[model samples]
Target: MDKSIEKKYIPLAAYFEAATKDKITLTFSEIETIMGQPLPNASYLNVSWWKKTKPPLKHFTAWTTFGYSVTEIKLGYYVTFEKPTTDSTSSTPDQDSNDHPTYIIRSIELDDARDVIGLYQQLFAETDYMLYGQNENNVSVQSFRKLISKWKVENSGTMLIAIINGEIGGAIAIIGSTIPRKKHCISIKMGVLEKFTNYGIGTALMTEAENWARTRNITRLELSVMKSNQKAISLYQKFGFVIEGERKKSVKIGSNYMDEFYMAKVFD
Candidate 1:
Protein backbone atom coordinates (compact mmCIF):
# COMPACT_ATOMS: atom_id res chain seq x y z
CA MET A 1 0.00 0.00 0.00
CA ASP A 2 1.23 3.47 -0.77
CA LYS A 3 1.91 5.45 2.35
CA SER A 4 0.29 8.45 0.73
CA ILE A 5 -2.86 6.56 -0.24
CA GLU A 6 -3.73 6.11 3.44
CA LYS A 7 -4.08 2.44 4.38
CA LYS A 8 -6.92 3.30 6.72
CA TYR A 9 -10.39 2.24 5.63
CA ILE A 10 -12.91 4.97 4.78
CA PRO A 11 -16.61 4.51 5.34
CA LEU A 12 -18.77 4.35 2.25
CA ALA A 13 -21.56 6.47 3.74
CA ALA A 14 -19.18 9.25 4.57
CA TYR A 15 -17.85 9.08 1.05
CA PHE A 16 -21.39 9.43 -0.29
CA GLU A 17 -22.45 12.31 1.93
CA ALA A 18 -19.28 14.15 1.07
CA ALA A 19 -19.56 13.42 -2.65
CA THR A 20 -23.09 14.77 -3.05
CA LYS A 21 -24.55 17.61 -1.05
CA ASP A 22 -26.28 20.44 -2.94
CA LYS A 23 -25.15 20.17 -6.55
CA ILE A 24 -27.14 18.94 -9.47
CA THR A 25 -24.37 18.05 -11.90
CA LEU A 26 -21.02 16.22 -11.69
CA THR A 27 -18.68 15.44 -14.56
CA PHE A 28 -15.37 13.68 -15.16
CA SER A 29 -13.60 17.02 -15.40
CA GLU A 30 -14.89 18.11 -11.99
CA ILE A 31 -14.03 14.75 -10.47
CA GLU A 32 -10.50 15.00 -11.79
CA THR A 33 -10.14 18.40 -10.21
CA ILE A 34 -11.38 17.12 -6.87
CA MET A 35 -9.55 13.76 -6.83
CA GLY A 36 -6.33 15.19 -8.32
CA GLN A 37 -6.37 12.52 -10.99
CA PRO A 38 -8.25 11.69 -14.10
CA LEU A 39 -11.11 9.80 -12.53
CA PRO A 40 -12.66 7.05 -14.60
CA ASN A 41 -15.82 7.98 -16.43
CA ALA A 42 -17.35 4.84 -15.01
CA SER A 43 -16.84 6.15 -11.48
CA TYR A 44 -20.01 6.46 -9.30
CA LEU A 45 -21.69 9.28 -7.37
CA ASN A 46 -24.68 9.39 -5.00
CA VAL A 47 -27.77 11.57 -5.18
CA SER A 48 -29.35 12.82 -2.01
CA TRP A 49 -32.81 11.88 -0.75
CA TRP A 50 -33.74 15.54 -0.77
CA LYS A 51 -32.74 15.91 -4.38
CA LYS A 52 -34.41 12.74 -5.54
CA THR A 53 -37.72 13.40 -3.81
CA LYS A 54 -37.99 17.16 -4.26
CA PRO A 55 -36.97 17.72 -7.82
CA PRO A 56 -38.84 17.85 -11.06
CA LEU A 57 -35.58 18.77 -12.89
CA LYS A 58 -32.95 18.47 -10.20
CA HIS A 59 -29.26 18.91 -11.07
CA PHE A 60 -26.21 17.20 -9.55
CA THR A 61 -24.40 18.57 -6.50
CA ALA A 62 -20.93 18.23 -4.97
CA TRP A 63 -20.07 17.19 -1.41
CA THR A 64 -18.02 20.16 -0.32
CA THR A 65 -18.88 22.91 -2.76
CA PHE A 66 -22.48 24.14 -2.90
CA GLY A 67 -22.51 26.26 -6.03
CA TYR A 68 -21.56 23.78 -8.73
CA SER A 69 -23.96 21.68 -10.77
CA VAL A 70 -22.80 18.11 -11.33
CA THR A 71 -24.04 16.30 -14.37
CA GLU A 72 -23.19 12.85 -12.93
CA ILE A 73 -22.51 11.17 -9.60
CA LYS A 74 -20.70 8.02 -8.38
CA LEU A 75 -21.81 6.05 -5.37
CA GLY A 76 -21.52 2.42 -4.17
CA TYR A 77 -20.36 0.45 -1.18
CA TYR A 78 -16.76 -0.72 -1.07
CA VAL A 79 -16.55 -4.15 0.52
CA THR A 80 -13.86 -6.75 0.92
CA PHE A 81 -15.31 -10.19 0.21
CA GLU A 82 -12.95 -12.85 1.57
CA LYS A 83 -12.31 -16.52 0.99
CA PRO A 84 -13.69 -18.90 3.59
CA THR A 85 -11.21 -20.48 5.96
CA THR A 86 -9.67 -23.84 5.10
CA ASP A 87 -10.78 -25.32 8.38
CA SER A 88 -14.24 -23.79 8.44
CA THR A 89 -17.14 -26.21 8.10
CA SER A 90 -19.74 -23.76 6.86
CA SER A 91 -21.40 -24.91 3.70
CA THR A 92 -22.02 -22.70 0.68
CA PRO A 93 -24.24 -24.33 -1.87
CA ASP A 94 -22.64 -24.81 -5.26
CA GLN A 95 -25.55 -22.97 -6.80
CA ASP A 96 -27.82 -20.42 -5.16
CA SER A 97 -31.56 -20.13 -5.81
CA ASN A 98 -30.85 -16.96 -7.79
CA ASP A 99 -28.22 -18.40 -10.09
CA HIS A 100 -29.25 -18.20 -13.69
CA PRO A 101 -29.45 -21.28 -15.87
CA THR A 102 -27.20 -19.87 -18.57
CA TYR A 103 -24.92 -17.48 -16.70
CA ILE A 104 -21.20 -18.25 -16.80
CA ILE A 105 -18.67 -16.86 -14.34
CA ARG A 106 -15.03 -16.97 -15.36
CA SER A 107 -11.66 -15.24 -15.07
CA ILE A 108 -11.09 -12.24 -17.32
CA GLU A 109 -8.60 -12.41 -20.16
CA LEU A 110 -7.02 -9.78 -22.40
CA ASP A 111 -9.45 -10.64 -25.14
CA ASP A 112 -12.33 -9.86 -22.84
CA ALA A 113 -11.52 -6.18 -22.46
CA ARG A 114 -14.27 -5.08 -24.79
CA ASP A 115 -16.83 -7.15 -23.00
CA VAL A 116 -15.56 -6.02 -19.61
CA ILE A 117 -15.76 -2.37 -20.63
CA GLY A 118 -19.22 -2.82 -21.99
CA LEU A 119 -20.44 -4.56 -18.86
CA TYR A 120 -18.98 -1.86 -16.65
CA GLN A 121 -20.63 0.81 -18.73
CA GLN A 122 -23.95 -0.96 -18.38
CA LEU A 123 -23.48 -1.44 -14.66
CA PHE A 124 -22.68 2.22 -14.17
CA ALA A 125 -25.59 3.18 -16.32
CA GLU A 126 -28.00 1.14 -14.28
CA THR A 127 -26.79 2.19 -10.84
CA ASP A 128 -29.49 4.03 -8.88
CA TYR A 129 -28.85 7.69 -8.15
CA MET A 130 -29.00 7.22 -4.41
CA LEU A 131 -27.00 3.99 -4.48
CA TYR A 132 -24.23 5.23 -6.77
CA GLY A 133 -24.45 9.09 -6.66
CA GLN A 134 -24.06 9.85 -10.38
CA ASN A 135 -26.08 9.36 -13.54
CA GLU A 136 -25.39 7.37 -16.74
CA ASN A 137 -23.33 10.07 -18.45
CA ASN A 138 -20.24 9.29 -16.41
CA VAL A 139 -19.56 5.83 -17.83
CA SER A 140 -16.78 6.03 -20.41
CA VAL A 141 -15.60 3.13 -22.51
CA GLN A 142 -12.19 4.77 -23.03
CA SER A 143 -11.47 5.05 -19.32
CA PHE A 144 -12.57 1.47 -18.75
CA ARG A 145 -10.10 0.28 -21.36
CA LYS A 146 -7.33 2.11 -19.56
CA LEU A 147 -8.23 0.44 -16.28
CA ILE A 148 -8.17 -3.00 -17.89
CA SER A 149 -4.81 -2.27 -19.45
CA LYS A 150 -3.35 -1.23 -16.13
CA TRP A 151 -4.69 -4.32 -14.42
CA LYS A 152 -3.16 -6.54 -17.05
CA VAL A 153 0.29 -5.07 -16.58
CA GLU A 154 0.17 -5.52 -12.81
CA ASN A 155 -1.36 -8.99 -12.96
CA SER A 156 -1.27 -9.24 -9.19
CA GLY A 157 -4.95 -10.10 -8.84
CA THR A 158 -7.99 -11.46 -10.60
CA MET A 159 -10.75 -9.91 -12.72
CA LEU A 160 -13.86 -12.00 -13.17
CA ILE A 161 -16.93 -11.41 -15.32
CA ALA A 162 -20.31 -13.04 -15.52
CA ILE A 163 -21.74 -13.94 -18.88
CA ILE A 164 -25.47 -14.44 -19.34
CA ASN A 165 -27.09 -15.37 -22.58
CA GLY A 166 -23.74 -14.68 -24.24
CA GLU A 167 -23.65 -11.12 -22.93
CA ILE A 168 -21.61 -9.73 -20.08
CA GLY A 169 -23.75 -9.23 -16.99
CA GLY A 170 -21.31 -8.37 -14.19
CA ALA A 171 -17.66 -8.02 -13.24
CA ILE A 172 -15.27 -7.67 -10.30
CA ALA A 173 -11.59 -6.83 -9.76
CA ILE A 174 -9.57 -8.42 -6.95
CA ILE A 175 -6.16 -7.02 -6.08
CA GLY A 176 -3.56 -8.60 -3.81
CA SER A 177 0.13 -8.67 -3.20
CA THR A 178 2.28 -11.62 -4.17
CA ILE A 179 5.26 -10.58 -2.09
CA PRO A 180 6.04 -13.06 0.70
CA ARG A 181 5.37 -10.46 3.37
CA LYS A 182 1.93 -9.43 2.06
CA LYS A 183 0.54 -12.59 0.52
CA HIS A 184 -2.13 -13.00 3.14
CA CYS A 185 -4.29 -10.05 2.07
CA ILE A 186 -6.48 -9.11 -0.87
CA SER A 187 -8.84 -6.30 -1.91
CA ILE A 188 -11.95 -6.58 -4.02
CA LYS A 189 -14.28 -4.38 -6.09
CA MET A 190 -17.44 -6.01 -7.40
CA GLY A 191 -20.22 -4.62 -9.59
CA VAL A 192 -23.32 -6.10 -11.16
CA LEU A 193 -25.81 -4.71 -13.62
CA GLU A 194 -29.27 -3.82 -12.30
CA LYS A 195 -30.93 -6.69 -14.15
CA PHE A 196 -28.46 -9.12 -12.63
CA THR A 197 -28.80 -7.93 -9.04
CA ASN A 198 -30.49 -10.33 -6.59
CA TYR A 199 -29.88 -13.05 -9.14
CA GLY A 200 -26.77 -14.53 -7.46
CA ILE A 201 -24.27 -12.73 -9.72
CA GLY A 202 -22.76 -10.87 -6.77
CA THR A 203 -22.43 -14.06 -4.74
CA ALA A 204 -20.90 -15.89 -7.67
CA LEU A 205 -18.38 -13.14 -8.32
CA MET A 206 -17.47 -12.93 -4.64
CA THR A 207 -17.14 -16.68 -4.36
CA GLU A 208 -14.76 -16.82 -7.30
CA ALA A 209 -12.70 -13.88 -6.01
CA GLU A 210 -12.35 -15.51 -2.63
CA ASN A 211 -11.31 -18.81 -4.12
CA TRP A 212 -8.71 -17.08 -6.24
CA ALA A 213 -7.32 -15.27 -3.23
CA ARG A 214 -7.17 -18.44 -1.17
CA THR A 215 -5.23 -20.15 -3.91
CA ARG A 216 -2.63 -17.40 -3.51
CA ASN A 217 -2.61 -17.88 0.31
CA ILE A 218 -4.55 -14.76 1.21
CA THR A 219 -5.93 -14.98 4.74
CA ARG A 220 -7.61 -11.61 5.17
CA LEU A 221 -9.80 -9.44 2.99
CA GLU A 222 -10.71 -5.78 3.54
CA LEU A 223 -13.21 -3.39 1.99
CA SER A 224 -15.24 -0.25 2.67
CA VAL A 225 -18.98 0.26 2.31
CA MET A 226 -21.39 3.12 2.57
CA LYS A 227 -23.09 3.32 5.95
CA SER A 228 -26.44 4.03 4.30
CA ASN A 229 -26.40 1.13 1.89
CA GLN A 230 -28.12 -1.41 4.11
CA LYS A 231 -28.51 -3.98 1.37
CA ALA A 232 -24.78 -4.21 0.63
CA ILE A 233 -23.95 -4.03 4.31
CA SER A 234 -26.28 -6.94 5.02
CA LEU A 235 -24.74 -8.94 2.25
CA TYR A 236 -21.23 -8.41 3.62
CA GLN A 237 -22.29 -9.38 7.12
CA LYS A 238 -23.85 -12.58 5.82
CA PHE A 239 -20.49 -13.33 4.23
CA GLY A 240 -18.69 -12.76 7.57
CA PHE A 241 -17.48 -9.18 7.17
CA VAL A 242 -17.43 -7.10 10.36
CA ILE A 243 -17.20 -3.37 10.88
CA GLU A 244 -13.67 -2.38 11.81
CA GLY A 245 -13.84 1.42 11.88
CA GLU A 246 -15.59 4.53 10.66
CA ARG A 247 -14.27 7.54 8.79
CA LYS A 248 -16.34 10.47 9.98
CA LYS A 249 -17.46 12.87 7.27
CA SER A 250 -14.60 11.71 5.09
CA VAL A 251 -16.41 12.49 1.88
CA LYS A 252 -18.33 15.59 0.81
CA ILE A 253 -21.06 14.92 -1.75
CA GLY A 254 -22.60 18.36 -2.06
CA SER A 255 -23.52 20.49 0.93
CA ASN A 256 -23.67 17.52 3.29
CA TYR A 257 -21.10 15.13 4.72
CA MET A 258 -21.29 11.34 4.72
CA ASP A 259 -19.44 8.63 6.65
CA GLU A 260 -17.79 5.44 5.43
CA PHE A 261 -17.54 2.13 7.26
CA TYR A 262 -14.38 0.13 7.07
CA MET A 263 -15.02 -3.58 7.27
CA ALA A 264 -12.80 -6.64 7.23
CA LYS A 265 -12.95 -10.44 7.12
CA VAL A 266 -10.23 -12.65 8.51
CA PHE A 267 -9.89 -16.23 7.37
CA ASP A 268 -7.41 -18.10 9.44
Candidate 2:
Protein backbone atom coordinates (compact mmCIF):
# COMPACT_ATOMS: atom_id res chain seq x y z
CA MET A 1 0.00 0.00 0.00
CA ASP A 2 1.15 3.57 -0.80
CA LYS A 3 1.89 5.80 2.17
CA SER A 4 -0.13 8.97 2.61
CA ILE A 5 1.07 12.32 3.91
CA GLU A 6 -0.69 14.43 6.51
CA LYS A 7 -2.75 17.29 5.01
CA LYS A 8 -3.77 20.60 6.53
CA TYR A 9 -6.53 23.12 5.87
CA ILE A 10 -5.24 26.68 6.31
CA PRO A 11 -7.17 29.93 6.79
CA LEU A 12 -7.60 32.16 3.74
CA ALA A 13 -7.00 35.54 5.41
CA ALA A 14 -3.43 34.58 6.13
CA TYR A 15 -2.64 34.80 2.41
CA PHE A 16 -5.50 36.91 0.96
CA GLU A 17 -3.89 40.36 1.04
CA ALA A 18 -0.63 39.20 -0.42
CA ALA A 19 -2.28 36.95 -3.02
CA THR A 20 -4.62 39.72 -4.16
CA LYS A 21 -1.83 42.27 -4.50
CA ASP A 22 0.59 39.83 -6.08
CA LYS A 23 -1.50 37.22 -7.93
CA ILE A 24 -5.18 37.97 -8.61
CA THR A 25 -6.09 41.65 -8.27
CA LEU A 26 -9.80 42.29 -8.84
CA THR A 27 -11.36 45.72 -8.42
CA PHE A 28 -14.93 46.19 -7.21
CA SER A 29 -15.97 47.99 -10.36
CA GLU A 30 -14.49 45.29 -12.54
CA ILE A 31 -16.47 42.61 -10.75
CA GLU A 32 -19.71 44.60 -10.97
CA THR A 33 -19.25 45.32 -14.64
CA ILE A 34 -18.64 41.68 -15.41
CA MET A 35 -21.51 40.38 -13.30
CA GLY A 36 -23.79 43.12 -14.68
CA GLN A 37 -24.82 44.39 -11.28
CA PRO A 38 -24.14 47.17 -8.79
CA LEU A 39 -22.29 46.67 -5.52
CA PRO A 40 -24.39 46.28 -2.36
CA ASN A 41 -23.97 48.89 0.38
CA ALA A 42 -22.79 46.44 3.06
CA SER A 43 -19.72 45.61 1.02
CA TYR A 44 -16.27 46.97 1.87
CA LEU A 45 -17.01 50.23 0.03
CA ASN A 46 -20.77 50.46 0.33
CA VAL A 47 -22.00 49.86 3.84
CA SER A 48 -25.43 51.31 3.01
CA TRP A 49 -26.24 49.34 -0.14
CA TRP A 50 -27.92 46.42 1.63
CA LYS A 51 -30.72 48.61 2.98
CA LYS A 52 -32.13 48.88 -0.52
CA THR A 53 -30.70 45.75 -2.14
CA LYS A 54 -32.98 42.92 -3.18
CA PRO A 55 -33.01 39.25 -2.16
CA PRO A 56 -30.08 36.76 -1.92
CA LEU A 57 -28.85 37.56 1.56
CA LYS A 58 -26.84 34.37 1.87
CA HIS A 59 -23.62 36.21 2.64
CA PHE A 60 -25.27 38.79 4.89
CA THR A 61 -27.02 36.07 6.85
CA ALA A 62 -23.85 34.02 7.04
CA TRP A 63 -21.96 36.95 8.49
CA THR A 64 -24.72 37.65 10.98
CA THR A 65 -24.80 33.98 12.01
CA PHE A 66 -21.08 34.18 12.66
CA GLY A 67 -21.42 37.44 14.65
CA TYR A 68 -20.28 39.84 11.93
CA SER A 69 -16.70 38.69 12.07
CA VAL A 70 -14.32 39.60 9.22
CA THR A 71 -12.69 36.22 9.55
CA GLU A 72 -15.85 34.72 8.12
CA ILE A 73 -15.00 35.82 4.59
CA LYS A 74 -13.29 33.20 2.41
CA LEU A 75 -14.17 30.27 0.03
CA GLY A 76 -11.35 28.12 -1.37
CA TYR A 77 -8.81 25.38 -0.48
CA TYR A 78 -5.10 24.49 -0.95
CA VAL A 79 -2.58 21.64 -0.45
CA THR A 80 1.20 21.31 -0.23
CA PHE A 81 3.59 18.77 -1.73
CA GLU A 82 5.51 16.47 0.58
CA LYS A 83 8.59 14.44 -0.22
CA PRO A 84 7.98 10.82 -1.12
CA THR A 85 8.94 8.14 1.38
CA THR A 86 12.44 6.70 1.03
CA ASP A 87 11.90 3.04 0.21
CA SER A 88 14.97 1.59 -1.43
CA THR A 89 13.07 -1.28 -3.07
CA SER A 90 10.15 0.90 -4.18
CA SER A 91 10.54 2.53 -7.58
CA THR A 92 9.70 6.23 -7.87
CA PRO A 93 6.21 6.91 -9.20
CA ASP A 94 5.61 8.73 -12.45
CA GLN A 95 5.19 12.51 -12.30
CA ASP A 96 1.60 12.21 -13.59
CA SER A 97 0.62 9.76 -10.88
CA ASN A 98 -2.11 11.22 -8.70
CA ASP A 99 -0.32 10.16 -5.53
CA HIS A 100 3.03 11.57 -6.54
CA PRO A 101 2.62 15.34 -6.21
CA THR A 102 1.16 17.88 -3.83
CA TYR A 103 -0.60 20.92 -5.31
CA ILE A 104 -1.63 24.30 -3.95
CA ILE A 105 -5.17 25.20 -5.01
CA ARG A 106 -5.67 28.62 -6.52
CA SER A 107 -8.24 30.66 -8.46
CA ILE A 108 -9.42 29.44 -11.86
CA GLU A 109 -7.66 31.09 -14.74
CA LEU A 110 -9.58 32.73 -17.62
CA ASP A 111 -7.95 30.49 -20.18
CA ASP A 112 -9.49 27.47 -18.48
CA ALA A 113 -13.03 28.88 -18.39
CA ARG A 114 -14.03 27.48 -21.77
CA ASP A 115 -13.12 23.89 -20.93
CA VAL A 116 -14.66 24.22 -17.47
CA ILE A 117 -17.93 25.49 -18.90
CA GLY A 118 -18.02 22.57 -21.29
CA LEU A 119 -17.69 20.20 -18.38
CA TYR A 120 -20.52 21.95 -16.55
CA GLN A 121 -22.81 21.66 -19.54
CA GLN A 122 -22.04 18.00 -19.83
CA LEU A 123 -22.99 17.44 -16.19
CA PHE A 124 -26.02 19.74 -15.87
CA ALA A 125 -27.63 19.86 -19.29
CA GLU A 126 -30.47 17.61 -18.23
CA THR A 127 -30.85 18.76 -14.65
CA ASP A 128 -34.14 20.31 -13.51
CA TYR A 129 -32.38 23.44 -12.28
CA MET A 130 -30.14 25.02 -14.83
CA LEU A 131 -27.41 27.22 -13.44
CA TYR A 132 -29.22 26.89 -10.12
CA GLY A 133 -32.29 28.23 -11.96
CA GLN A 134 -30.53 31.56 -12.43
CA ASN A 135 -30.64 31.18 -16.18
CA GLU A 136 -33.93 31.12 -18.07
CA ASN A 137 -32.88 28.16 -20.18
CA ASN A 138 -30.96 25.02 -19.32
CA VAL A 139 -27.24 25.22 -19.87
CA SER A 140 -26.35 25.73 -23.51
CA VAL A 141 -23.20 26.36 -25.50
CA GLN A 142 -23.99 30.05 -25.79
CA SER A 143 -24.61 30.42 -22.06
CA PHE A 144 -21.26 28.88 -21.32
CA ARG A 145 -19.63 31.34 -23.70
CA LYS A 146 -21.21 34.31 -21.96
CA LEU A 147 -20.28 32.94 -18.55
CA ILE A 148 -16.65 32.54 -19.55
CA SER A 149 -16.51 36.10 -20.86
CA LYS A 150 -18.01 37.43 -17.66
CA TRP A 151 -15.59 35.45 -15.51
CA LYS A 152 -12.67 36.68 -17.54
CA VAL A 153 -13.59 40.29 -16.92
CA GLU A 154 -14.57 39.95 -13.26
CA ASN A 155 -11.25 38.36 -12.31
CA SER A 156 -13.04 36.17 -9.78
CA GLY A 157 -10.82 33.15 -9.18
CA THR A 158 -13.52 30.99 -7.64
CA MET A 159 -14.29 29.13 -10.88
CA LEU A 160 -12.24 25.89 -10.87
CA ILE A 161 -11.82 22.85 -13.15
CA ALA A 162 -10.23 19.47 -12.51
CA ILE A 163 -7.72 18.47 -15.16
CA ILE A 164 -7.02 14.79 -15.73
CA ASN A 165 -5.40 13.24 -18.75
CA GLY A 166 -5.43 16.73 -20.30
CA GLU A 167 -9.23 17.01 -20.19
CA ILE A 168 -11.61 18.77 -17.82
CA GLY A 169 -13.99 16.44 -16.01
CA GLY A 170 -15.46 18.65 -13.29
CA ALA A 171 -15.91 22.32 -12.48
CA ILE A 172 -17.11 24.90 -9.91
CA ALA A 173 -17.79 28.63 -10.15
CA ILE A 174 -17.85 30.77 -7.00
CA ILE A 175 -20.11 33.78 -7.39
CA GLY A 176 -18.81 37.24 -6.56
CA SER A 177 -19.63 38.91 -3.23
CA THR A 178 -22.88 40.83 -3.07
CA ILE A 179 -22.03 42.99 -0.10
CA PRO A 180 -19.05 45.34 0.03
CA ARG A 181 -17.72 44.12 3.35
CA LYS A 182 -18.38 40.50 2.43
CA LYS A 183 -16.86 40.65 -1.04
CA HIS A 184 -14.16 38.37 0.20
CA CYS A 185 -16.64 35.53 0.67
CA ILE A 186 -17.91 33.67 -2.40
CA SER A 187 -20.79 31.25 -3.06
CA ILE A 188 -19.95 28.18 -5.11
CA LYS A 189 -21.62 26.49 -8.10
CA MET A 190 -20.26 23.02 -8.83
CA GLY A 191 -20.79 20.12 -11.23
CA VAL A 192 -19.02 17.04 -12.56
CA LEU A 193 -19.61 15.42 -15.94
CA GLU A 194 -21.93 12.41 -15.81
CA LYS A 195 -19.20 9.96 -16.67
CA PHE A 196 -16.83 11.58 -14.19
CA THR A 197 -19.03 11.01 -11.16
CA ASN A 198 -17.67 8.64 -8.47
CA TYR A 199 -14.18 9.02 -9.91
CA GLY A 200 -12.81 11.49 -7.32
CA ILE A 201 -12.92 14.34 -9.86
CA GLY A 202 -15.37 16.43 -7.84
CA THR A 203 -13.39 15.95 -4.65
CA ALA A 204 -10.18 16.92 -6.38
CA LEU A 205 -11.67 20.12 -7.80
CA MET A 206 -13.18 21.05 -4.44
CA THR A 207 -9.97 20.28 -2.60
CA GLU A 208 -8.08 22.48 -5.03
CA ALA A 209 -10.52 25.35 -4.57
CA GLU A 210 -10.41 25.11 -0.78
CA ASN A 211 -6.64 25.12 -0.83
CA TRP A 212 -6.62 28.12 -3.14
CA ALA A 213 -8.89 30.04 -0.81
CA ARG A 214 -6.78 29.07 2.19
CA THR A 215 -3.65 30.28 0.44
CA ARG A 216 -5.34 33.67 0.20
CA ASN A 217 -6.58 33.58 3.80
CA ILE A 218 -10.24 33.15 2.92
CA THR A 219 -11.94 31.80 6.02
CA ARG A 220 -15.27 30.51 4.73
CA LEU A 221 -16.64 28.63 1.75
CA GLU A 222 -20.40 28.80 1.24
CA LEU A 223 -22.88 27.30 -1.24
CA SER A 224 -26.55 26.50 -1.74
CA VAL A 225 -27.89 23.22 -3.07
CA MET A 226 -31.33 22.14 -4.16
CA LYS A 227 -33.27 20.50 -1.37
CA SER A 228 -33.63 17.38 -3.54
CA ASN A 229 -30.01 17.04 -4.59
CA GLN A 230 -28.99 14.54 -1.96
CA LYS A 231 -25.82 13.39 -3.72
CA ALA A 232 -24.33 16.88 -3.80
CA ILE A 233 -25.36 17.60 -0.24
CA SER A 234 -23.69 14.41 0.87
CA LEU A 235 -20.44 15.37 -0.81
CA TYR A 236 -20.44 18.83 0.80
CA GLN A 237 -21.07 17.35 4.21
CA LYS A 238 -18.20 14.90 3.84
CA PHE A 239 -15.92 17.87 3.18
CA GLY A 240 -16.67 19.32 6.64
CA PHE A 241 -19.50 21.57 5.44
CA VAL A 242 -22.44 22.29 7.70
CA ILE A 243 -25.91 23.61 7.13
CA GLU A 244 -25.94 27.20 8.33
CA GLY A 245 -29.44 27.99 7.11
CA GLU A 246 -31.98 27.70 4.31
CA ARG A 247 -33.94 29.92 1.96
CA LYS A 248 -37.59 29.09 1.41
CA LYS A 249 -38.96 29.47 -2.11
CA SER A 250 -35.65 31.00 -3.05
CA VAL A 251 -35.38 29.68 -6.61
CA LYS A 252 -38.14 29.98 -9.20
CA ILE A 253 -38.38 27.18 -11.70
CA GLY A 254 -41.29 26.83 -14.14
CA SER A 255 -43.49 29.01 -11.93
CA ASN A 256 -42.58 27.03 -8.83
CA TYR A 257 -40.51 28.12 -5.86
CA MET A 258 -37.77 25.63 -5.03
CA ASP A 259 -36.16 25.73 -1.63
CA GLU A 260 -32.39 25.91 -1.22
CA PHE A 261 -30.19 24.75 1.64
CA TYR A 262 -27.24 26.95 2.46
CA MET A 263 -24.09 25.10 3.56
CA ALA A 264 -20.69 26.37 4.64
CA LYS A 265 -17.21 25.26 5.76
CA VAL A 266 -14.92 27.47 7.82
CA PHE A 267 -11.20 26.82 7.38
CA ASP A 268 -10.03 28.82 10.38
Best candidate (score: lDDT):
1
The C-alpha stretches of model 2 lying farther than 4 A from their native spots are 1-107, 129-156, 178-180
lDDT of each: 0.55, 0.51
Candidate 2 residue 88 Cα shift, in angstroms, is 23
Among these predicted structures, which one has the highest TM-score? 1
Cand. 2 TM to true fold: 0.51
lDDT of 2 by residue, 81-152 (tens): 122334533433432232322122234444444455555555555576444422333555566657766766
Scored against the true structure, residue 89 in model 2 reaches a CA lDDT of 37
In order of appearance, the predictions have TM-scores of 0.54, 0.51
C-alpha RMSD for every candidate:
21.4, 18.2
